[model samples]
Target: MTMQLLLTLLLAVARVKASTLLASHYSGQLYTLSLSSTNQLSISGSISSGNRMPAWLDLDSASRTLYIPDEVQWGQPLLKSFTVGTDGAVVPKEQIQTSGGDLHSTLYGGPNGKGYIALAQYDASAISTYPLPLTGAGQPLQKLTFTMPQPGPVPSRQNKPHPHSVFTDPSGQNLLSADLGADLIRVFRVGTNGTLAECSPAKSGAGDGPRHGAFWTRGNSTLLFTVNELSNSITAWSVLYQPGGCISLLKRQTTSTFPPGKSAPPGSKAAEVRVKDNFVYATNRFDRSFGAQEDSIATFSIHAASGNVTFVETTSAHSFFPRTFSINAAGTLVAIGGQTSANVAIVERNVTTGRLGRLLASLKVGNPGAANQEDGLSAVVWNE
Candidate 1:
């Protein structure tokens, strides 16, 4: 290893204590993130990948490995894993070749936090489940792919396998894949040893273009809320939990994201949707247009029982493209990430009523776009 690389590792370990970071790849490398003692200071760290691109990073607690959706021309995009040393150097662990084309995003965990990775080939639509190992290095998973129901009413776009994001159900009995191209959410059932059992499909209503989704809170709830990139809105759905190993949608309704104006373009979808406490936050991106640089964070109060969301307030933070933001372990501060600015904004939130405040300390991103909108901020990972 080069001396420069070794020095980079030592600096990272000093900046963060008691918390690890989520590394995002963009502008050609992955960025490390962390918060201050008060969860205010947002820090960025990076490790170079000669020609490999790091995308859609996931922290696998069971394996203590950071998984990156890496693209290398030699073969296919891999679910590459790494071990973070005590001094913060990320040592490569495993590079599992995905059978179902390029691995998109590490699917959100099920009710039990059982990890699964979702693979989506643009021309095809499906989800694959990788059993999260119980301990030690994460076990290599055999791709258990679930092709979506093609003959549904909206078969034109829905005909192909276009899985975007995957997550397990609150009961851990089901897995769901949000199909952006198809505008439908696919569901599945899981076994103890990480086997998937098929079941019913819970629709996300018409043309919502579901992107990344999450529940109102952890454990126990029929409320499933998802971020719809096309519709430029977030929606709530009441799940009719059934006894026959199936879940039916009870209701699907939308919430406002932007003020009445030109709708979001086709490609730049809603980035990351997260639910902390009773508040659900969505970050809508302009990717290219970069028009409304004023209003960013869309805050909504979540109703867990009815699966409904009411507008709390839209943050006027001047972030270019806020993609992903995470509340601190104390839920006091939220670290906001911009896909275009390549910088993170540290914002404070009132956990009681879902109000937000800007923080004092901010970490300017490294390797910033010495150029333009083609690059900006990546994802944000917080340390407790």
Candidate 2:
């Protein structure tokens, strides 16, 4: 064989191996997908979740446990846990009934040095905490409810307090909830024995409707960046870690998620926000103006000192209504789940320039549906 041909064969043999990805669908299924080094995608396995709308998933790598929240709007929702086997099989472990509309959850360490699951119930206007290693249908250790004194600027969406997401801060001492209906980022202190105490909330712009957030730390500074669904904007806040396991978010900058001089379409809404290295990425849904086929993912460059972000560019998601997406551990590929398109797209990413490249692969997993109807894909997560 020729020398060049021999080198090519060797490179192919040494290429990155395929990885596993877990995706949640509104059709009550958890799918295990195989992602090849060449960026191809295929469903390897799937299991029924036994719930109507398992809309969000949180995987605890340390325990090989996956937490799924049933985003049911009508009756009481359920929080289910499963053991993820080595072969990608998910075995149900426990299921607990919770207040309706359990949309998001996260695992965090409590003051007792044990782990706890913090859940956000949007329709219920409540937050709940449960101890880790769920065994049975146990009750929550603490449940907190919120009431909005007045309607927000956007009365339609902010008529009540809706906590969209609950996440642990960088300090690992506090929990923050993005209250979309109240225009506040509610702070909570994790106390001994996995209890939660309410703290002063940080205010956002009127009608911002903060849905989800990601944190970035530089030296001693930590910044919280939230994707506002109502305003179609991104806001950066300086996270101040205070004594007694609490925090204060001071607003730093607010910028449109769309490109400069461009705004979101009438029905468009910002979905997800994520940070990798020095770059931040946010998604916009129902905006076909950017792409003929689907919505767009907005990229921004983060200023090291101020934590302010500058708009980088927008890239087509290659699928309609990109509700959720996950970046691999290598940060080289993005797996996007289109909520209304019922498809998953793998796109190349540039770690150095913070720019998204061409679409490598796309797979149709199920049937499509209307926006926010809970009839398609809900979450996509890498298994690394």
Candidate 3:
């Protein structure tokens, strides 16, 4: 072949490796999402997650599997597994009963290609650890279970322990669970045998109701950024690694998820919080009771040295109830899921300023069950 022709063929192959975005919904389906050159998003394919509400979605690329919680019925929570194909298709594999209901899960990559799948149950107020098998056929075996403690200020949501999410630390030797009802980020030491042991917690301001969190590290300092649902704000905590590999979090700063002087409407709550580059993005959602609402994504610039956050600006999400969003690996695009609108929107990001540009794409995915209009988009994940 001619050298020119060879080079052209190589470029085309490289383009095919571009990342694909996946979105899960309250409708009980997961869609393979793609954004075209024309800035239009298309659903390439979809897999049914059954009737259960897959409120959270995450991919384990190393194992080529997807983990989801089946909280369809109270007192009968399940952990579902699926094999993710190269073309972004998913095949349902196994479903095992978990320790509790309303669970959110994540995989911990551990020693020798063997690790555990960690789940946090909201209704049961517990964390369950299980052995992750490579075959993806048999039921998962439980290794340990930890009941989370609830300490509160908000009477409505803080009536009990509510573990919103579970995350494996970068060190692979610890775990962090964001307890929304407790106003604390609890730390746990991951034993070599996959058991969990409690450690000192990083406390948030009362009534904060800390939800989900994302971590970023620079040098020896690791920072955890969490979204506060009740307060409509975000908090940053500096992590201190102890001598025995245990860790603690110290609150560094908190900032409103809404624009300055613009009080969030009543019943307003903050949802997902994500970090990319030196910036953090969070969603602000409000109930329909607020006539003129401000449902948007607030972007903030993070100081690398101090892990402090400064509000940059708020950008309209182009829809209501943006429950979740994912940034492409390239850091040039962001996909947001509007739960109440049953639609997804894409926006461009300014890498230099960390400010969002105008919305580039918007399309309705339709609600899960009926053909009618009712928002149900739940979570979004970017697979690069």
lDDT of 1 at 56: 56
Q: What TM-score would candidate 1 get against the native?
A: 0.76
lDDT for each residue of candidate 2 in 1-384, tens digit (9 for 90 to 100): 987677556535533787788888898888988877776789999898867799898987667789998888766677889888655678888878876578899887765334888889997889988887775575888889999788989998999999999998886788889999999999888776778888999999999999999999889989999999999999999988777768988998999989899968898999999999999999999988556658999999998976779999999988889999998766778899999999999987876788999988888876787876768899998886
Residue lDDT tens for model 1, 237-296: 776677866676655678757644555555445667887888888876653443545336
Q: Each prediction's Cα lDDT score? A: 0.60, 0.86, 0.75
Clashing pairs in model 3, backbone N/Cα/C closer than 3 A? none
Best by TM-score: 2
Off by over 4 Å in 2: 1-15, 74-76, 111-114
Answer with 1 or 3, whichever has the higher lDDT.
3
Candidate 1 clashing pairs, residues 3+ apart or interchain: 110-168, 124-161, 125-161, 125-162, 340-376, 342-376, 342-377
Best by lDDT: 2
Q: How far is candidate 3 from the true structure (C-alpha RMSD, Å)?
A: 5.3
What lDDT would candidate 1 get against the real structure?
0.60
Whichever of 1 and 2 has more lDDT, that candidate is 2
Q: Residue 304 of model 1: what lDDT?
A: 53
